[model samples]
Target: MSEPTTGPAGAAFDDFVAARSTALWRSAFLLTGDRHKAEDLLQAALVKTWRRWDRIGHGSSRSHETAEAYVRRALATTYTDWWRRRWRGELPTGELPERAGDVDEAARAEVRHDVLTALAALPRGQRAVLVLRYFDDLTEQQTADALGVSVGTVKSQASRAMTALRSSPALTDRFGDAA
Candidate 1:
């Protein structure tokens, strides 16, 4: 397929967006589990990226990997920020409370719902750390850089999250099967 050409800045930006937009939006949606929120998060990240496009391009990396790193980090932090606003109550949900639990693939869907709920219930820092460490496969230092926190913070967050997840019956049931 022929590529769309605009200008140096516009074309470069457009190409970057076109190539990465779908994956980034999907990642955002998976992280947030809300379509509207995902759209807002991705848009915000892209806008910030566009503002820094010139400076970012001036860096040494030709692959735009640094830009991708920035976008992922921004989106992750934004999701965590939005999640905190929704955590006003102190109630605990052991099983899945999701309304979208109905699925033709009942067994797996049940496990997935529980996992999502568990992830959502985790403290913002812990959840972000877990997702960065396990889901995104980023190292502690990378996760710390992404969240603008220290590596020690990442380690502590992961330690706490792992402890809680291990104590969680839902996760034990789900993950035990994997092991």
Candidate 2:
């Protein structure tokens, strides 16, 4: 991803960043299962969205200046493109040594890690569907629009992704045992 250059339209971009970057980064971590990778993903998505802010933020109605939709769309597109091209293996979400000091911190970290690993194991398109539908609490049509796919695709992706997760050993051990 390229660096963010300066421009007059940057105010809207800046507003978006100030409002949403942290939550987006958190969602990114869940989607990516890596803090560093999530940061990179957030920066890349932000840059891409900022580049198009003018057209998106043009003097139009509220629906036209949809920053959330734009960012989500950029993230889904970037992630799907990268996964298609690279097909990277799942990132391990096992607790890192960095979490050793505090018990409460470690437990929270562990849970986040397991969930992320479980989620990231899905195909990128499916993972995007999951993140948008569940993590972002978006509707099927919202996810479909964000991913540039169809509502049927979103449904199938979520169903397939959930089936895969339920059968996954990590998820079974971490969450299924409670069922």
Clashes of 1: 0
Maximum-TM-score candidate: 2
Q: Stretches of candidate 1 above 4 Å error?
A: 1-6, 58-63, 83-104, 173-179
Report the number of clashing residue pairs per model.
0, 0
Error of 2 at 53 (Å): 1.2
Candidate 1 TM-score over all chains jointly: 0.74
Tell me the tens digit of each residue's lDDT in model 1 across 16-104: 88888987887776677556777998999888788777766723446467778888888887777766677566854455344465565
**lDDT per residue as tens, model 2, 135-169:** 99999999999988899999999999988888877
> Pairs clashing in candidate 2?
none
The best candidate by lDDT is 2
TM-score of 2: 0.82
The alpha-carbon lDDT assigned to residue 82 of candidate 1 equals: 69
